[model samples]
Target: TVIEQYEFCRVHRKEEIIISYKIEKGYPLHIDFTILPNWIKSLKDELLKIIKGQQYSEYHVDAPGYYGTKGLAIILKTLTEMFVQSKILTTNLCIPQLLSQYLAQVLVPKTAIRLIAEDFNNIFLDMAKKIIID
Candidate 1:
């Protein structure tokens, strides 16, 4: 229902993306990154390997209220950090820690959000390089 509606609104570009879910009594919450780009998906796979067991599920018990929020904020924040570290984006342009944390409840959901964010940052960096060189 919510997913279908979100898809519909997304397809039409009529509304900002919003995810809603209920925490099942025994089931662990999961974030679906299917709508994100392929690079994000691949990065997620890689991060999952590197991070070992520090996945989204580990944060569930600690931050049950954040389950409904989109992982976009975390993704963006990670990308900003990566860019700053690599000098692709200036440190001055980086998002403030307070604001970034406020936007995304968790900073290190390394399995999904962090990986996806890094992928997006890489894609943006590549595009920026191409544009600057061309």
Candidate 2:
């Protein structure tokens, strides 16, 4: 089953969208990510409740030490290191927005994006193949 397919456009940073890709478009796509403590403590339980309600139902982080959300914990970790470097420090969403644009443009191009999409499609096809084989 194709779960969802969407295109991300960088209107402000228009140069970022090289190609649209499918993040995950099939069943058995494991979105179950790890959790972190820093995000939980900093963002708080209220935020977590909201996230869970939105179907981001995974938490693989220890509390009090990391204090970060599972999916975004890596970003948080990087941001903290940047803060230590005397860079701009704040709860600014602009950084993330720009980073998103970078991913759309620089990291994931049309070919790469298409590859990932095909991968998802292949997963579904393989599952069907397996059922037939069984």
Candidate 3:
């Protein structure tokens, strides 16, 4: 019998992000991903809509002093996640640092990040379908 395994990992730093993947035999492999809450996905969609300038009437109001740029939603969301996950000694909320890091890493080149996210979704869907079929 033949057994194969695959492993993936990512390292983050101020300079650059590094990703590694390897395949081996005999040894077991495990993958772990932080499951983002559904609220985050909804927020991302809302931010995307605003950035695309498809705001509805409810979102038309302006604050006391601001351009009402759609980009603010993303910025707020990032900060919220950071503050919640960080859980500093002084703060009560437990910010998720890993998610913050992942988002920061992807947002460097926005267009490229979007394309890569789309590709990852498609590939994962294909893999899911294969799993169902077999």
For candidate 3, the clash count comes to 6
Q: Please tell me which predicted candidate would have the highest TM-score against the true structure.
A: 1
Q: Rate the local accuracy (lDDT) of all candidates.
A: 0.38, 0.31, 0.30
Q: Which is superior by TM-score, 1 or 3?
A: 1
Mind giving the per-residue lDDT tens digits that candidate 2 earns over 5-32?
Answer: 2223334234233112112323223333
RMSD to native for every prediction?
A: 15.7, 18.0, 17.2
TM-score of each model, in listed order: 0.22, 0.19, 0.18
Query: How many clashing pairs in candidate 2?
Result: 13
User: Model 1, range 99-134, lDDT digits (tens) per residue?
Assistant: 344223332343343342343454443342232222
Number of backbone collisions per candidate: 0, 13, 6
TM-score of 2: 0.19
Off by over 4 Å in 2: 1-68, 90-134
